[model samples]
Target: MSRHQRLLALLVPAILLWPPLREAAEASMFRHMLVVFPALLAAGWFVAGALNARAQAAFARWNGMGLPGLLYVTVVLTIWMIPNALDLATVNWDVDVAKTASLFSAGMVLALSLRQASPVLQTFFVGNWVTMTIFVGVLFQALPTRLCNAYLVGDQVRTGIGMIVLAAAVGSVWAYGIWRRWRASAVVDDGTGVQSS
Candidate 1:
């Protein structure tokens, strides 16, 4: 099977199973809302990657590795969004909305990163990083009030840890962009090589 097909095969079950699993939790409604954005974002990223892959394939660039990397990243994000089987409350409308927004924002950043031909991708990546930093920083700062009620009812550690991991992922991506730019600039491309402008 093609890598894209294999990825979809793995991802389909996870996406299908998430809703029911989240619904089984005590906070079913809240958890469901929280997942809605991530699920949509995953779907959008997958579709875009597939379309881009097909385009590249038709143009004889099927061996290109970019789309697969994007797909893998989307898969990782999907797994991250999956609530732990032991998670207690499934429903917190406020926190759900905030989490969903954050997921969407992250997905936008991923999409921007996948635009290999666009120099604008760099701008989008940096811009989205700043936006994500502000958004998550605010969420972390307001966690006390926003999550206070849920915290009283469920595992605060799980929520806190998840946020921390997400922050790390965002930071890692930002660092990667910077590193990639530095590497691109440092390379002295001979006439036979195509250097990024």
Candidate 2:
């Protein structure tokens, strides 16, 4: 895509961090947990994609080195997924800054790692991640009381529903990607180097 297109795409997510959207995000756990987090992540991912090839090369190098980097991303992801963490980000300025940084960083790492990892590994990561999302969703739904000081029970319920829906959607996409990859690989297995539609 062109530079302008890239800029626009990047801005689309960054816009979420601005006044109106930012206010909306901070208003409840559902928006914070799902909308704002995703928007920031998309901003990072899009920015990474728009950058010169150097960033890609760097992510590729990091991925090539193996588990340490992936482990780091995993930890960052897990930390931010916590309700307490979300509450902190909502109410504490310091924590909010950290949240933005960590979320974006995690997004960059995740996007790069996924790009470099083998399909099996990618599938494994997605499977595990989605499973966690589902678990968390169920937990959120089951919680008898509000888990975060900033959000109400209703917000938590909505967040839980969003999580479950997101998991299902991502799972479907991952399955489709796997099927496509498998079909492509199978076509190349015959050694003729031909691609099958």
Please give, for residues 67-161, the per-residue lDDT of candidate 1 as tens digits: 44344444445433344412222354344334444454445335534655344544454445445544544454445543434333234434444
Model 1 is weakest, by summed lDDT over 10 consecutive residues, at 80-89
Worst-scoring 10-residue span by lDDT in model 2: 65-74
* Per-residue lDDT of model 2, residues 33-150, tens digit only: 7877777777666666676788678667757833554566667767877888887877777787777777776666676677677777777777887898989998888989988888
Clashing pairs in 2: none
Top candidate by TM-score: 2
- Candidate 1: which stretches are off by over 4 Å? 1-19, 25-40, 52-113, 116-138, 141-143, 147-161, 189-197
- Cα TM-score of candidate 1: 0.44
**What is the clash count for each candidate, in the order shown?**
5, 0
